[model samples]
Target: MSAYDAVLARQSWSKLTQEAPTREELLPLVAAAGRVADHSSLQPWRLIELRGDDRLRLGAAIAEANGDLKPSSKPLRASLLIAVVVSFRPSEKVPRWEQEAVASGVAHVLSLLLDEAGWGVIWRTGGHTRTAAVAAAHGLTENEELLGWLYVGGKPDGKRPGRRKPVDAESLLTRLPSAEGIAG
Candidate 1:
């Protein structure tokens, strides 16, 4: 499929099966994601593929982090879960926030590719995102952050439509003082 088609057709798939992305497949996906707009080539992030026992450890961490909710409830559902991590290395040229944005951009593109490849993808983040134990499990230092959990699996034969609305072009664009600006 074309790149545009992949971008447009990509959807957040939550209800997925046990089949997941293989290590070989994931390497290419991560490479594509690393091609995102990272300012100054800081390369300020990393990703950890969590599966099998790692997923169990993550689920336990989640359950411990959240008292009321059962972490085991939905943690091990996927055959592979990629933990999208953002690292801050004290850059004078790039702000820490922007580095985080680059990581998110990579995650977005990776999700799109996974969807196009027939694997259901879900980007998840919660209280565990900011927890110290979870952060340490993935070797994220104090300046680093856990952006999200990218869950991958086989798409169910029948799935619900994604929650999306058509973009209001007029509301999204304005006549900025630029040569390519679209007048209001």
Candidate 2:
């Protein structure tokens, strides 16, 4: 499919199978997604892939962070979880917020690539994402922040739910007012 069609067709797949893309299959997509617009090529983002026991560790950490008595099965929702981290870089021109946006863009682009590659993907985040326990579980450093995780697996075989509503482009699009109107 064309890039435009792929983008428009992309939707979050919450229910996914246990099958996931192998590391070899993922590296190329990651590289392509990393081509997102960066002000100074700071590359302020990194991804950590989690599977098996790693997911269990993250689930436990999430439970602890939420003060729950039992471990959470959230991380086990998919066979693979890619943790998105914004690694802040000290730059006189690029501010922290811009860097964070770059990181977020990378994640979104990666999701699109994954979707195009026939993988079910969803970006998941919560209030506990930045908690100490969760950060420790991901081994986040002082300069890094947890953006979220992309849960990935094979798309289940069946018809999905209703299609997404079309965006109201006309209502959303606008141009600046004329100079006379602005002055008035």
Tens-digit per-residue lDDT, 1-184, candidate 1? 9998887777777788899888998888789879999899888889899988898888777777666455665668788899988887778899989999998998899898888878888899887789876776777887789997998899888776367677698989966677556455
Identify the leading candidate in terms of TM-score.
2
TM-score of 2: 0.94
Question: 39-70 in candidate 2: lDDT tens per residue?
Answer: 99999999999999999999999999999989
Please give the lDDT score for candidate 2. Answer: 0.94
Q: In angstroms, how far off is 61's CA in candidate 1? A: 0.7
Model 2, residue 13: distance off in Å is 0.3
Which stretches in model 2 have alpha-carbon errors above 4 Å?
159-163, 177-184
Q: What lDDT score belongs to each candidate, Candidate 1 first?
A: 0.83, 0.94
